[model samples]
Target chain A: MTAHTSSSSSLGLISSATAISQGAEAKVYYASLHPAPSPASTTETVDVLIKHRFHKGYRHPSLDNSLTKSRVAGEARALIRCLRCGVHVPGIRMVDAAEGVLALEWIDGKSVRFLLGGGAEGEEEEAADSEDSDVAEAAAQEDDTDPLSEYGATQDELMAMVGAEIAKMHRGDVVHGDLTTSNMMLRHPRSEKGLQLVLIDFGLAYTSTLVEDKAVDLYVLERAFASTHPASEPLFASVLRAYQAGMGREWTAISKRLDDVRLRGRKRSMVG
Target chain B: METYHYPSFPADASHVHIALFKNVSNAAELRSRIVRASLLEGSEGDLEREAVNFAFIDARLICSRVHLQTAIYQAVLAHAQGALRTKTVHSEILWTLNPSNNISEAIRRYGVSDTTAFLIVVRISTANDANVLANMQAVVSGELSRFSLEGITDWASVKKYYKLNSEPALKIQGITLVQERKIIDEIVTSTVAMKSVMT
Candidate 1:
């Protein structure tokens, strides 16, 4: 009744899951948390997003194992920190470090990038995780309505949600190292915690209290906006306003630091 | 009782049979027998272990079916890797559910207690292995019940065990109690999944 090899169980979950997208560091898959409940019973299993930092042939086996294990653990830590801090991040569903698999609550929503018209030219159209979006997307296109409207948020409010969510994470002292539009999503309007902005991807996130770290986080996101969206100033201003409102008294110093960051670029002037 | 089949696991350990028993009457005797089974020796030990091999869980502590399944999946994953924290995958499931590294604490808190009226018996083995439902019924005197987590979760115990009382996630203004429970379930489920990696 035993004597099974290591790592295959999680790989089994992955094999059952449909591969959605692949990145240089990890591959993402969509799957149910349990085997679909028997057809006789109408109970639906929860869906989970599986992120696997697959094995690399170039690195030694032990080193690869340790690296994969640590990275997966680090990402899980960041996500848990966000969840505890009341940030709108997907809850972690599972973590199997030995297999480099991290499972997250599957978000049924559209990425902010697509809602903002920035997804068309992007490399990773991670905007829509919804498999049933084809019909809704087609209808939205037919009406020529802004996709953001369907989520019940105006562009201004979406930006505000984005800013506030980031502020909450910063308030918790967790910095998202990457803050692209694609990394943030608007939960489907009808789901639990409807139409909220949820942040995803903590692969590079870290804990920090330094105002400089927070400012740099804003700066990186600002740059992402400039490069990805046309006429980005107003959009970024909306984000910062909500961010400033959320940050309250802590906003002033970070704002000044952000301005300084903008002048010198993301990299600070280094001295040996 | 419904069986979940995992296509990826080895044939011997591919399926998990779960039976929820309500109004369990012999939990006290069942608990003592389980203890005795652990201490018995030789062929007698083998027979006793086989008789009560299922992981007997207190249904009140489980927030959602996802919470239970996550533990089972992690246990299977550990068993497959030969890195089980306990002697068997069944115990590993209990350990994962307990939220602490102490094995005894896990079993004592999550295992079937004398007062456990709602019991969940789980067995992971080949799908062809018969008598799973019969065995579960034989070990515990209770009525077979539909599998649903509604109305049974003891929220106070769950929140206290997870230490979610003052956490900011629940402290958010305007959040309903239902919303808070959803958050708790999510946090607890994630904790179970990440037990091995938690610092």
Candidate 2:
């Protein structure tokens, strides 16, 4: 009953928010905590990203509710663990787990995928607008001069940040079940820590102390890079190098396991 | 004093009033009064309760304005949905700040103590009554200052309460004290935000 009330309230909030993306399991929205400020005021409104895991029609009603609740809780927990480990993940702003709504701090820069020229198909049109006229107009209207340059990081530097952040998460025994360029973001140059890489989308993440799990995490990212980016081998190698440096002595075992994982895929054989 | 409106909540419960009180010399008296008010009955008790209706948080434990705001927001959310774990939204704010689920422990650590010097008081209401600020000032015997967060945080106590000394986020190399505190503040505020769902 409480879950029902909370879920309906969360749905109401989402209904009012501007939908940013719609996926199979959840929908993302751009939202704000504070009301819109006056036109003349220079104060900044707090922006948030709301991730709502809506009800699944395929599953039974009760089963779907429980699954959504648990998944939302799990994701929030993994993110908190990552933050404690110094991993660059979006900070949570609000969570209604029973309602399957999680609000997070809105990172104000482009995704690594977009910056690396592997933007999603839907974003291609917006990404291609490199004309100086519109850019100048936008620059005059807003603070950001150019969205792409806001990160101020080279491709190699971005990769290194990605690898180092992942290593930190793995060292804390958290496995990001999904890791891809699309899930990593580079902070705007004007942010507190300019040009920092932030990992996002912990909906599939979980905690595991096993070396196998850690290796598999890295392998997933490697595969993602190889598929998404052109000439990704050297880029991934640099990522591993930074990861190795971050992990130090712990890297040796995970590196060997990763090599084996790369050969055998994500699944471990159970035939033995 | 600052006010926030939550569009998702009912109008009666949407308005939030927050004020910071520094140099609080009557903390011990306020604590005792609150305890006494809890045991009162009928109109007399109602009057006593009205006097100390705000969440009197120990400001020293708060990392930043955002940290306090996060707890207040979550508490208000729980209240709006009829899912409050504690008796009232004011107490719930304190409950959400503690890492553990123990209600009394949360109050003991985050609630105003006899030795409390700095305090952050918050009230969640439906109406933006003109008397709210005056009422708060009447109850608290401390100086009301601008709600600026700088220089008000007790980082040492915060790290102790959150157990951040062993956290890897603080152990990273090349992180200055200011940067480390920023990370800690973000993490702590985030933890409070999601405390309701934390298992």
What is the two-chain DockQ of model 2?
A: 0.55
Each model's fraction of native contacts: 0.61, 0.60
For all predicted structures, in order, the TM-scores are: 0.93, 0.91
- Residue lDDT tens for model 1, A9-107: 777778778988888899999998677654345466678899999888888888998999999988988888888778989888878898898999999
**Over the stretch B1-199, how does candidate 1's per-residue lDDT look in tens digits?**
9788888777778898888899999999999999999999999999999999999999999998888988998898888777899999999999999877999999999999989999999999987888888888879899888898789999999989888888887888898889888888888988888887888
- The parts of candidate 1 lying over 4 Å away from their true place are A1-7, A120-143
For candidate 2, write residues B1-199 as lDDT tens digits.
7777666776666777888898998999999999999999999999999889989999888987678878987887788777899999999999999999999999999999999888888888876566888988887899997776678788988888888999988987788888988998998999999898887
Q: What is each candidate's DockQ, to 2 decimals?
A: 0.55, 0.55
Predicted model with the maximum DockQ = 1
CAPRI-style docking class of model 1 based on DockQ: medium
List residue ranges in candidate 2 displaced over 4 A: A1-8, A36-44, A121-150
DockQ-based CAPRI category assigned to the predicted complex of candidate 2: medium
